[model samples]
Target: MQTANNCNFRSSALGPAPLPYHPHHPGLPLALPAPVAAAPALPVPVPVAPVAPLAALPTPPPPPPPPATIVQTLTRHVPVPVLVPKPFPVPVEKLVHVDRPVPVEVPVPRPYPVAYPVEKFIKVDRPYPVHVAVPVPRPYPVPVAIRAHYEPLHHHHHRHHYLHHHHDW
Candidate 1:
């Protein structure tokens, strides 16, 4: 049967047999592997010598004094105001209306049988020039010789020479 001391092994079949708790019986001593012999002791190292302290550095010279500044006072004048003369005022009046009789208009007598000039339009036959259709002469096709040379003009001198030679053609 399994017990607390025998819990080290997961399988009870391979574990050690469990011992009963006894107040008088002393517990069985744990069976451990034999103690291993320690390796040989290493040699002691020598102590290092202490270093000397460094010397203090010399103090630096003081900086130059700053330049002096100038102070000045400024003054300004104020302008005076001038007075102008005022113009004279004009008087205004209201108009009054008076009742008056209007004159009667007289009709003038007209002369009998008034003569008026009448306008007359006459149709006249005039001969005009007539347009006639005429056939235009077609230009005859002429065969011309054309020669083209494909060349790369890399230099400015060569391009100018080629243009001058082809200008006449």
Candidate 2:
């Protein structure tokens, strides 16, 4: 069999090219041809017309108040009374008494001994006297030059000292 690219001839030359002939087995074929039957003839139906148009209706008046019954229209009106609660009473307590036997039992305690101690006298000796040495004064020696220098200064200031001492005026 020839591949697609190898077949260069135009298709119109062979009425649709005979469907590329495929190879079949000598003993068995892949698929057998199926048989077909023609369709049955159907009956033609007659056409139907639409229903007639509805009549124009008159607007109905509101229905009369359901014809009032005698028991409902003549009923009476009554107001119920309010109930007031009552106050509760105060409670009182009760007393009870009981009796029993009494017993008298006294306890006796043991006596403890008292203790007395003996005394002894002790003597202390006095300390002996001690002798301490005292320091004696020594006479200081005077320098003649010092006494002479101070004599002149003392005499020069005698008049100032006397004037300060006398303030009678």
Candidate 3:
């Protein structure tokens, strides 16, 4: 029987066991082999050459100058003027006086009347009678009973007999 951890199927002499079908990729192989380690890389070879001493060369002579040729020459002149501003005079102000009217004392009357109406009141007498019936509670009866002849108490005797019988057991 196959367990959860070891779910890989084994092949028999009859034929190879059918691979489990996947819902997505139906063409995938069932059993894959363990991965192999990569091969070791070989070292690359580098070439070394011998160094030689350098020799200094002689400097070349300066080049000869070409023949000279002359072109036309031009000259121009312009004039600019300098200006100076003159000073302005300061203005002077004069004051004038005018007379206004004087106020007089006058009395004014009130807008509404000063007097109001007097309030009147009436008095009532004779009272009405009201009667309420209050409930009075009655006293409860007291229990009283007289026995002609009292029977002998048996509960204490029964308890004593039970205790003695249990001690003998």
C-alpha TM-score for every candidate: 0.11, 0.15, 0.12
Ten residues in sequence with the least summed lDDT for candidate 2: 144-153
Tens-place lDDT digits, model 2, residues 12-116: 745555433335443444466676856867878878896655655556888778632222111211111111122211111110111211111111111101111
Model 1: per-residue Cα lDDT over 29-95, one tens digit each: 4554578979989989989897655545555778876642311211211111111122201111111
Q: What is each predicted model's overall lDDT from 0 to 1?
A: 0.25, 0.23, 0.25
Between candidates 2 and 3, name the one with more favorable TM-score: 2
Q: At residue 155, give the lDDT of candidate 1.
A: 17
**Root-mean-square deviation (CA) per prediction:** 46.8, 57.5, 59.3
Model 3 clashing residue pairs (backbone) = none
Q: For residues 1-169, what per-residue lDDT tens digits would candidate 3 score against the true structure?
A: 4546654455475477677754355666655666997897887887879555454455577887663232111121111111112220111111011121111111111211112111111011111111111111132112211111112222122221111122110
What is the Cα-based lDDT of residue 141 in candidate 3?
Answer: 16
Which regions of candidate 3 fall more than 4 Å away from where they truly are? Answer: 1-17, 33-35, 40-169
As a whole number from 0 to 100, the lDDT of residue 123 in candidate 1 is 12
Model 2, residue 75: displacement in angstroms? 6.8
TM-score of 3: 0.12
lDDT of candidate 1?
0.25
For every model shown, the clashing-pair count is 0, 0, 0
Worst 10 residues of 1 by lDDT: 121-130
